[model samples]
Target: MPNTSRRTSKRDLTLVAVLVVAAIGLITYLVVSPPGGDDGAAQQPAGPSGPSASQSEGSAGADESPLSGLARRDEGDPTALGPVDAPVTMVMYSDYRCPFCAKFSRDIEPELIDRYVDSGQLRIEWRDFPIFGEQSEMAARAGRAAAEQGRFWEYNRAIYEDSPERGHPDLTREVLLDYAHEVGMPDMETFTADLDDPSLDEPVREDLRQGSSIGVSSTPTFVINGEPILGAQPLDTFVEVIEGAAGQQ
Candidate 1:
């Protein structure tokens, strides 16, 4: 395992506590609120590293709809895959520039898709939670633009597959356009236009806001069926969570 910094360790602890508290708060809200109430609220393709199972062991239970407002169950959502009513929904908050997010995309996501999404067991939703500063924000916008053209996933994979294993790289307009072209976005003019359009930026910003509200301070944070799972944990961890959630449904 890579040596964790004190800051990271502290953040992990805080995240776990936040998740537990959020879980408890959710339970209270559900128990008291009226029924049928209306609620308001990746990456490349890096290699696997060490275990992150120890990072988040929160009390967040999958049995409750803790993330119902954020699950984006709309059948027409372009950034989501699998059936809208899939038994389990995996909401991934990630940055385009985060290497760990890339690793998760490259190493583990494909298997999850094959085993869960393709089989009508899971739906994966992408949230643009860029936190690495300007370039990160730009990348998020570019991703949203691609998503406008129905090429979000492909553009995201291109970004990660082209990324280095460490450090932040400059994701200038030239490079982002290159990625868009590489993804075979049929209408380059529309794609570029969308990237330049300010209106295309709101979903990414909303994602960041929603993620922050749930205490996500890092890229690649995931909430699977309302159960918080941190980092690019081993595939087995995902298997356990997905199967458990699916079984419950």
Candidate 2:
């Protein structure tokens, strides 16, 4: 293919670097073997279309359990950030105004976090990709603001949890301020000022461009240990990715 893309920004390069490192870590972990079956990690299905009836039935019992779709296993690996020691790392590039992003954050991420991250087995890195114009820009800025006050993840969580109606107010400064208050992030003035900085803005743009360059055309796109998984897929899908990567090691 011809190289038709324009100039790449430093932030975009940085986001690509993050994805590359994450991919290497995950693939490296895959050369090993897992100790036992994890109810949290979903196995790959039999056929192309989807899981066979029998497979679904087999997974039914595991699904009912609390840890049904959570990745199980922690070995205290270094170079981890979010949920330390996670055997599988899932990096997400998302837009706060995206409905799918909201869905993944409120629904899918919890089980993943509780089982993988909190247990020191998984690290979830979030890249805010702004694609919907001004509101998206607002949301991205707000995320950086939250980061400034050490409440990035919490503030990130709240936006998705309190998703707004389409065409309604979203990513507003006041709404973000409200979220900051709820999450205990003070120093709004400082954060707002910081948002104007190019260094702060580039990561989001880079994720947006880099994700597209890598065929991530939508929000909530994930890089699991270096593999790209699109949309707010089911937990079982994530489990399969993790286990597959782990088994390769």
Candidate 3:
């Protein structure tokens, strides 16, 4: 983790709490977004250590080698998102509103879980990058609320799996709570209260500020060591980045 020095303001924390809840709403948008999140909420892809998203577009040649020779398929954490204790730490700045974040979580997170996180070789950290959309904040808060019940992964996964479903609904507190109920989480009242806990606000703001310093401008921007890997890429890209990071230690 990076060193902490900056202090957050009251407004920032307030925004943090709201963003968490809006994350749920963002997931709802995913259900109605185009495949691969290419229009509207999906913006231009940024450059990477290798080829940029622009380099592989328009011609329709396909990027089969995007992450070639990058990672070995492996089993990851079935029930967790962050790392337990990894020598290499991979940090992600993601907005629930960004369909790309949904894609990355669905496609790449599993490989990280199977090969590195589950094996204790790498520790992965996710920082909310809600992008301050209409309801992005809510979705993030919803995830945090679920985290209080040790069911963050379940809620996050549920959102991804349903990203392609028909119809849409605002990701309200009731909806998040409902998902919690479906996932067999603990008491709803207790977890729901944690969502409003003033003490929890600081961490969320701190994450936002820290991510800004590293040039992250969108969802699913990743940093391995001091290098940046921007965009929602294939799992193999993650493998290359993660393995390089793990080898550093």
TM-score head-to-head 1 vs 2, winner: 1
Candidate RMSDs in Å, in order, are 10.0, 14.6, 16.3
Structural RMSD, model 3: 16.3
Top-lDDT structure, candidate number: 1
* lDDT per residue as tens, model 1, 1-249: 345566667755664564466456545654654322333221110112111223112212343444443465666788889998788889899888877788888999999999999999999998888877888888888898888888989999999887766555679888999999899998999888876788867777777767765556666788887677777789999999999988976
Per-residue lDDT tens digits of candidate 3, residues 1-249?
122322334534554454454444444433453333344113222222112344335212332222111111112422234444455656678766555667777877887788877787876666776774646677777777777667878887777655532122356667667777888878887877876676655545655765543334555666654345666667788788778767856
lDDT by residue (52-155, candidate 2, tens digit) is 45534543552232112122112331212454345566767788887767878788888887766777656776666676678888778778767766778788
* Best-fitting candidate, scored by TM-score: 1
* Model 1: colliding residue pairs: 41-69, 44-160
Q: What TM-score does structure 3 among the candidates reach? A: 0.62
TM-score for every candidate vs. truth?
A: 0.75, 0.62, 0.62
Rank all candidate structures by their TM-score, best first, as comma-separated numbers. Answer: 1, 2, 3
**Each model's lDDT:** 0.74, 0.59, 0.57
Native-to-model Cα distance after best TM-score fit, residue 112 in candidate 2, in Å: 0.2
